[model samples]
Target chain A: METGTVTTANPLNVKAKKESKSKEIARKLLRSWTGVIGFSLIILLLILSIFGEVIAPFDPMDAQLRDRLLPPLTDGHLLGTDQLGRDILSRVIVGARVSVVIGLSTVLLAGLIGTIVGVIAGYYRGWIDIVLMRIVDVQLSFPFILLVLVISAVLGAGLTNIVISLALAGWVIFARVIRSEVLALREKEFITAAIATGVPKLQILVRHILPNIFTPIIILGSLQIGTYIIAEASVSFLGFGVQPPTAAWGNMLDEGKDYIFNSWWLITFPGIAIILTALGVNLFGDWLRDTLDPELKGE
Target chain B: MSDILLEIKDLGIQFNTGKGPIQPIRGVSFSLKSGETLGVVGESGSGKSVTSLAVMGLLPEKKSKIVSGSIHFNDEDITKLSEKQYRKLRGNEMSMIFQEPMTSLNPVFTIGELLSEPLKQHKKMSKKERKEAIINVLKQVGIPRAEQIINEYPHQLSGGMRQRVMISLALLCEPKLLICDEPTTALDVTIQAQILELMKEIKAEKNMSLLFITHDLGVVAEMCDRVVVMYAGEIVEVAEINELFDQPLHPYTQGLIHSRPTNNSRKSALYSIKGQVPRPEEIGIGCTFANRCPHAFEKCLKETPPIFEKGDHLSKCWLQDSKRQAVMK
Candidate 1:
């Protein structure tokens, strides 16, 4: 007995149903306080990063000698001017672009490299697994900061170099996490079915293995963004990232530290910005893990 | 013989583990004729699945090797086929449906995507042609709402529907030989009946040879033309379906037939063949089933029995020997 109604049903109906299901998930996510606050903060940071140039009240690089070290509640400067008499509010907003860019870029680069390495190692196994895993082990054994510093020093200090160095240091975690995920996933019956179906090894890795491990990768990426942001700040503080006049959060923090005692606005404002952004990314990451993880859903 | 689609002669598979090398399949031999359903019946650890995997060229490469024997498909010895050559044959000339339907289909893919994969890999067809072919096969397997079901993921369907999808997948390339390894074991009774019925219809319509592997004798009686009884990695008997049930020659085969619970025997305790199937490492020089056979004697314990043929029925037990039968009497 063939069904008459479903045969004539529009294919667009499936798309509509999928859209509604995602909308329902979004509504459920916003029901929790963590989701609401984390989402709002993430939105705020994204806005600040995108619209920093237009939104800043004064040019971040413009110096106002008379307005130097203006404290909170000042007329011209919102958060206050830094020791260089540059608008702290303007610089912080502009700094969002650098922090977000470096954090996002580092995560993307590292995740791409790590996921590829991990999938290859986990899928082929044998000597490839042993060799790749040994390399990961060697990298992980070194102090993370020292490795980054060495990489940064070799590449020379700049925005791109910092992202590169951070990604090099950061990828080990992803490689480790995804390799284990891929290892477990390779044993799944669908993979065997795919092999039995004559699917090429590369296609199976891309189509079957990659999609299944995406949730973990996304969760790991979001969490790592906070760490990368802090790392950029640390590297910049050491004079190895985002040179002066660009107003990156890390370099801004480096400049503000000298005036930490007297001009509290300098260090305080930048410090608060860094903390808030890191907090936002971390909170969003946690909520994402809870929402995206199939095991944790509906409970 | 000319119509034999696939034949395995003395196939042996050895898995090298850290403990030592263990031979899971030793001297497994059978032939599946064109348009015939050959059932390989065995309990778990009987090397049924391993033998099927070896046929598909899906065995774990680094750990296991084909220690002895040859698998000939359409006159070609597939055991020696390179990986690339096997890839061309797999899903093109032959395909397999696995035991666990729940885990066999990728969860992330839609039914349409899953079905389209084999066509894309082996067949040269335009997108529209592929879709039409997919819907045709899906409907042939008795899946309703073909268009609607295509867009749904594996998790959206029940176990029966997924198994149907898997069957449809295996049939997509129209492979000459279809190996069903316990395809209906995971389903309940009603669903199992429906799947088996569907498979029979498909096999008839396509004239595809089927290597049906299952431990369920009931399934073999319903599905098979001929049956191969494997015990502890060795074939104890091979017979036509009706003859094997009518006059099982080997003691092990007799025990298996008697062990089935019948309508009249339901009230009594079910007859069971005593002792577990021996682990691969535990097997020695004697007949593997000698310890469990009711008629096992000095010869059965000290030496292995060669396959004894009486007409078309073959049994691997000392009891099959005329001299041994006379001595026992």
Candidate 2:
């Protein structure tokens, strides 16, 4: 009925109304305490990742043997120094870049590969479905960490290889979720209507199927970013990720573990940074799932 | 008036199941003239919907195969057309409107987006021209507030409004033939009438041939110039609308007509033909309705009856044989 009155309104007004709807969602998001904290934490991490080198007072890689193992509130070092006397605050600041980059890129690469496999398997079905799903099953049967460790070990250590190995391990979840979504959606009459309308199969997959499955993809991507961040830290701590002498939180933790009994700030700062990033990502993902899920929106 | 827009000859479709291949459609044949509405009346499992899907070239590819027959649309045998060729004709020269309006429109797309698709696919229209055309079609389909409705998603509209949008979608290209598979069965009575009226107005305006598939005999009476009654995947009767209703030759058609509850029969038990329609796999060499036919004889149980023509009316039943009719008289 409101549409009746809005009929006379110009297209610009309609576009404005659409913008307001999203703005309303943003307003609702900020009203919740979890949303506020999670959002702020992510923003803080983003800023740290982008401007870490510029803002860090001391070069993260520079070591001062005389200042080794200094406690918090030392001169020129806010959080103190590591066993190598590297500034803990600067290391933690720069470590955010590695975690965010590895986390975001891994999810992106994994999501792309998985969604294509899923849409193909689901839309075509029969032997194609069986083959792809069996591959997914074989991949999924392995423990998540074991799979990542095995892949990282085989590929050897580096930034790109870690992202690749983690992506290979993480894509199965996305494939499984997206495949099931496509399986359900392909049977809907709208899909048949699209086919009858002469829309090409690829167009149907991209325009119709992909858009419908985007919510799950976004939710899965957000949730997986947290998992990948932790996975990267674990891999890097094992020396299979961003190598030593780098300001990655994982190797920083590895370096500081030796002096943990004497100097607490070394490992404590990096550990807190990893936990905060993961926690923030997970909280934001949960809120996103709740808000975007139409079924849950009734509450 | 005499020009045939579409023709089907002995269309047989088989579905491959785990058990075995079962032929659901067997020797089904019919034709639609350029501006005529042909109603296909049948019950569930009668293969009416399957036949329509075959016509649209939308049948599940790996599962169902067209084992026999040809579908000639506009003088070309569409059954032989490649998928690419079929695409050229589909949603261009011919289009289909499905039964469930609720699920037919993509929920994520706005009405304008849905309508613009067929235009984008088949016609060479610019964005502005397409928008103008979409608004014009929406208005022609009796959708009020067409401009605003175009911006709204499918979920925002009621069932009747969505059905109108679907009609406008089917009409976007001014298709020569429109296949509607029980389009009104899902709507309430009032909405059903409104949709039927809108379709009739559009059909006349466009001079489009309509293949209307429904199990409701009332709809057949109102919308069809000719009717094809299908039972067990085979057409048992084909006749002009008045002739089929007044003198339903096939026992199944008669049973269908008699079973309709009327005020005259308010105090009496409604007449119903006994026995369910045999499934495709259960059909044998004999007449499909032999078990249910009140007038069935030994011959009806032994052999399948061929189509017996009487001027414009055709009936597939042993009872329609001249000798049998004379004996009965």
RMSD of each: 2.8, 3.2
In candidate 1, what are the lDDT values of residues B1-118, reduced to their tens digit?
A: 4799999999999999999999999998888899999999887899899999999999999999999999999999999998889999888889999999999998788888889999
DockQ of each: 0.54, 0.52
lDDT of 1 at B252: 81
Using DockQ, give the best candidate's number.
1
TM-score of every candidate: 0.96, 0.93
Clashing residue pairs, candidate 1?
none
Per-residue alpha-carbon lDDT of model 1 for A146-223, expressed as tens digits?
Answer: 888899999998888999999999898999999999999999999999999999888999988999999999999999
Show where candidate 2 strays beyond 4 Å: A1-8, A30-33, A54-59, A72-79, A262-265, A294-299, B264-275, B294-297
Candidate 1 overall Cα lDDT vs. reference?
A: 0.90
Q: Model 2: per-residue lDDT, tens digit, A117-153?
A: 9988988899998999999999999998889889999
